[model samples]
Target: MSRSHIALVGKIAAIACIIFIVFCICFYKTIRTGFIEAQFDRASMYMQGEGNPQDFKKAREYLEQSATAGSDNAQYMLGVMYEKGQGASQDFSKAMNFYKQAANKNHAKAQYALGSMYDHARGVPEDHTEAVRWYEKSANQNNPAAQYALGYAYYNGIGTTKNIDKGLQYLQKSAENGYVKALFYIGSLYFEGKNIPQDTKKAFSYFEKAAYKGNHDAQFYLGVMYENGNGVKRDYTKAIYWYEKSSKTHSSAAFNLAKMYKNGLGVEIDYNHAFELLKRAANGNNIQAQYYLANFYDKGDNVPQDSAKAAFWYDKAAKQGDSRSAYRLGEMYIDGRGVNENFDKAFQLFQQAAQDGNVQAQLKMATIYFKGMNTPIDHNKAIEWYQKAANQNNSEALLALGNIFDQGLDVPKDQAKAVGFYQKAAEGGNVEAQLKIASFYLAGTNLPKNPAKAIEWYQKAVDQGNIQAMLALGQIYEQGIGTTEDYQKAFEIYSKGLSSHNADLQYAVGMLYAKGLGVSKDIEKARNFLKKAAQQGLVVAQREYAKLDLSNQVQDPNMQTVISYLQEAIKNGDAESMFILGNLYLNGNHVTKDTKLAKELFMQSCEKGFENACHILKTTY
Candidate 1:
């Protein structure tokens, strides 16, 4: 070959080599593109049921391979796969790792996922403060979820000072991005009047947007607003429709729907469906749902009564510090309704309830101490416990304390203090205290005599079933103490009093008859009522019965009855009975005039704290 031809051939060969290298580079780029596209295609096919019947397992494998190759979209998809355990072992840590990787590449969904992981402590220690940092980073990048999360943190004071204004600003920005959750949260803020001038119209607008996006909580809130006419005009049909929509997945919404059905508020009453819905809510650990379900089981309200089931739910709520549950548990233990009778357990449970500020429990503990039932009597402890309850404005406690002071049970008798406590309880609407307050005035013990006030209080008590108040009214009308005497009204009142079980009431009736206060003087009726009162050991009645005329009165068989009645009354610490018995013996009218027995009875009455008996013993016997 010629020398010129050889040089041209070498140059051509070098050019050919450069062309081959360029061709190889283009071929490699095509293969790489195809490989990535193929993985994406496979993932999409599996995800969409186009291949392998929508197998998450196959989709995850394709997504994992592409994600490992540094594809931001694939990394985001892989994070979701791991999060949902799609064709893989559920791994929040792996999901978070993929999310963080994609987030570093400014993948919007991945940024939101990483922020949520930090906020919820899923696959990492929960750090709302750190979550805010990451969320702000993504929010600056126009990530809707990050913006919404940042808004939530600000509104709720989560790792930040609550700033509803700033929260609404960020939330509105996210809403502009079509973030449904942001709209829902902002709507809730407006509806609840949280740190914003409440705007129910704007709230309803936001909620409607989120509800259209199929956000369950937003739907539930929309239903609530419609039901309550808070953000919308009252519309039961709209409330029921939205509630049914939300109840499909939300147990709380289901519970609300059940309540509506139970009360016929927005739907036809359907107890069967209501029961099913409530059970779902109860299973979700809704405390109010559990309480209502337990009550249904306890009462057999359209369901089988089951005390055990009632106790089961009550215990569940009690462990969560529900005061009413604790009280019910105490009752169950005390009564052995759904558990073994255990007074000690009941007492402890009652203490727990009382510490939680349950007035019923406090009063119960006081009554136990005061009555010494199943425990030793502790009057001081009783008073202390009652005072604790009374400070909470418990009328029963105040009345019990008033009575204790008035009767000097364990404290010095103080009518003034008694009246003060009674007034407190009376103002608290205690009918018993009202009657006692009136009695203080009528007897002129604590306050100045005020007949009008006495009658007023007595009338209030009578309206509350106070028998004594009724009898007192009868006497007032009969004697014209506070009003004009009315004999006909007095007879009617005395008749009512006589129908009661109080022997003193019967004696009053007998006095009305004996004095001809209402009816024509009827000796037969008078004697009959006196006999009834005497049988109840009334000392005056016994003396009157003994004074009845009879031929051979000394030898009359009724003398023996009088002596027996007087002896029984003396044994009951009646001072007048002792005096009358002593007089009988001194006159030799009964029992052969036994002076020693009379002296013994007199001394016994005197020692029983009766001053009249002491006087009789000193002067008569």
Candidate 2:
């Protein structure tokens, strides 16, 4: 009962002292936490005006007190209040200081705020490296925004040495966390093959993921990929679906969808739908859509033909540097199709479009300058514009240049240069140029005569259905110019020209039948062909048609029909028709004798240079 009892009493006393100290520490911490929370609550209430007047001054005071007491949330709030100048003078430096304090305490939001300040030089010296440092801290804690920022910095070498692999790795992490922008960037990198092997399939997959999350850009890309078969089989149906989805926000998507609808791709042709889509895209400021929409209004393709609407759309596209639209609008101004005719405005627009390298506009400029359309004619300017357009291999421009040189219009005649331009135009598929070149070779004009070359160029024009070339070729063959005469070939060429219904060609065929040069001699056939030529007001044919009856020694069975045909020719001012009809009336072969009418017809024909009619009038009267 002596030493053991004293030791047990001392141990009990020590255990009681430890328990009292622990309780005092816990009570003190609880009170401090409650006080900080009360301060923060009051600050929030004052800032938000909870049942009281909003007092930013009082809110800042309470937030400062709470922040000083080591509250990370309070520190971040104080930074915002200082930055915004809520009841205090705005001080970025002060805001940055508070953000730094909270950031150092491992507050993710504060770390991101500090990163943005450094990145954008907001309240701090611009330092991408420092920004990356802070962003990394927050990113490591799974902050999607910070992760994206850090990835972008690495990818662009903004804050660190460029490391595409590392950047993609961080971006993938952010994308996995559902960051829409991160997904889009990653997809773009792969799609463009920037600093990495192009992986369209992978890019498409990532874009699809973002598209499903309502990213308009991603949706547009998905449409492009599907339509072009970039990484998969081309699927117009799917492409249209994606394009329609993105068309609300993406003008390019709307334009593409409109084109698809217009071309009947992956759907039934619906011009009305195409028109609506084009209107949407044009309103969104798409240059191509505006241009095509103008064409639709001009042509009455889907909408009622509206010249005013065409001009409006053309003007919109022209302002955006569309050369074709500018040229078309210029044309409208000149024609007064939609607006009052204003040649000055048309000239100005044409000049603008010509300078922009529109081939048609350059040609128009040449024409206007040469013709002096609503302005003084300047042949030099016309030549300059023609040269410009010719330089672009415009066939019509080359043909125009040839004509200018050949005609010596405002320039010394240069037949060699004219032939050169004609040759160029012919090679470029200008049928008129081909015919001109052929004529040059045939007539030995401005160059050594070459029949083979003539035939070659003529054939080129003939291939394009040039009736003049066909007749020329037939004449060449029939006359045996620098070649053996081939009547059969001449007949074939003349037959091709028959579709033109040209009086000369019809007479030529009649002569061939009469002489049996290119066809069998048949008087009936010759008479029929000559009759057709005579009805078309051919003077030589009408004279020959009248002489044929005297040579045949047999009156035509259809004398009244011949009289009617001659009457029609006379109405067309054919002197030969008047002379023949006058002779018929005097002879009374087809009608009762009327000497007075016959003398009047003879006098009319004599006035038109019919020598036989004058002789008959002088001898009979």
Candidate 3:
């Protein structure tokens, strides 16, 4: 009993000593942590000038003390200060040290900061995969910024193979955690709908969230959605409201608001406010706003015409690689409207825009090179630019190329290639090219003489009000060139051109009526048409009108006039005119009696199937 009691007492004493020692150690740590927290708080207050004037030097001293005492928050803050050069000269290497200290304790923001250092190569070789690994760690701890970084990396395949669905999931998580950029970016994806099904309502929802959270782009899009009535009821008032909010910081939003004021879309037409807002947007480097502002000045639409101001804005936007603006500035330079005329400068600008894929600028470059404007003629460069524009389906450029090949203008004549370009231009709605292709089809020049194709292309031109095409199509039907002689089709086609006062069209229509070819033989219509054609001095119509007098249709007929008409008609091989003139000679009605002349005229008329002349020749002769 004595041995057991002594052993138990010793054990109790030893147990109490261990408990007391452990309590003392825990108490020491508690007091030290409290001291460190106070030091960190003082440092934050000093840095932020809260309740005192800011003193970066004092803040750094306090932060260093707290950080050395193993406070993760203090360590992270000191890291930011060193990394950003806040309290002293920047030292990313030291920042990396403090950030590692805090990150080792699983501080989410510190982990994110460490990832950012590696991501941006701050005191470390840039390593996106390494950044992504840390981002995943912080994201697992529900750090919204880390989640956003991870999502962006996945979205763009920066650190891992691209996975839109996975990226979208992480972005959704970040947005749910109130990351404004993630909200806005996700909203854009829904709005664009290129890789996903378009869901405007869903996009509006995300944008609304981001807008309220101070995302200017989201605010601008909200205005757009409201104004366009996309995924929402049309409410210009709400649109203007959102636009005004975003316009404070976003140039595009200001530009849109300016348009609403200018056009009186949902607000009073206020040119003053419109101009002010437009200038604001333009000065802010909104490319479209700059272009429109330049146009307003150039055309004097709303403001005083200031060519210099227009050129200024155009130059601004052109420097930003706006093709349309570059081309416009080139024109101003060429015409000396805003600056001293400099063709070389203009051509340089044109080439800039042409290289940027502006179809009009491409065509202009082609024209400049082809015409040797401000430079030696360079058909190769011209062809290059023309082909670029033609590739974009520019009808003018296609037609020009066709003409180049067709006329052998500084290039070897290639009828086959010319036909190909002409066909392309015609398909692009170039009326001249349509007519060219039609003529080719009709004449079997470069293209087969397919009447159907000719008629098809001619009709295309006719629909565009081309009188030449109308006349050509009319002649095709009238003369039965490569097809049946469709008099009715010919008459209809020619009638359309009568208003154009074309002598050929007038004569054709008259002949059709006089011969009872298309419409009924209306002598009055036939006479009116023949008179109009004759007044226009058509040689063919004059001969035909003279022959009409053999039917006794001319109102003021005289013997001399009648004799002259008959002589002209005989040359045209008219049997009736020959018989009438022969009778006049036999009777000496308009000339001295001459049986030999009369007999010769009668013989010619009889051989040409004039029954009356044949009867006279056999019985009276």
- Please count the clashing residue pairs in each candidate, in the order shown: 0, 0, 0
Poorly placed runs, candidate 1 (over 4 Å): 1-31, 176-178, 199-205, 231-238, 248-256, 266-277, 302-305, 372-385, 404-418, 482-621
Q: Write the per-residue lDDT of candidate 1 for residues 99-177, one digit (tens) a residue.
A: 9899899887788788888889889999888888788888988988889999889878897788877877889999999
| lDDT of the candidates, in the order given | 0.82, 0.89, 0.89
Best by TM-score: 3
Clashing pairs in 3: none
lDDT of 2 by residue, 323-343 (tens): 999999999998999989998
lDDT for model 2, please: 0.89
What ranges in model 2 sit over 4 Å off?
A: 1-179, 182-203, 408-412, 491-533, 540-557, 560-621
Q: Which digits, one per residue and each the tens of the lDDT, describe model 3 over residues 494-527? A: 8987888887888888888888887888767876
The global Cα lDDT (0 to 1) of model 1 is: 0.82
- lDDT minimum window of 10 residues, candidate 1: 547-556
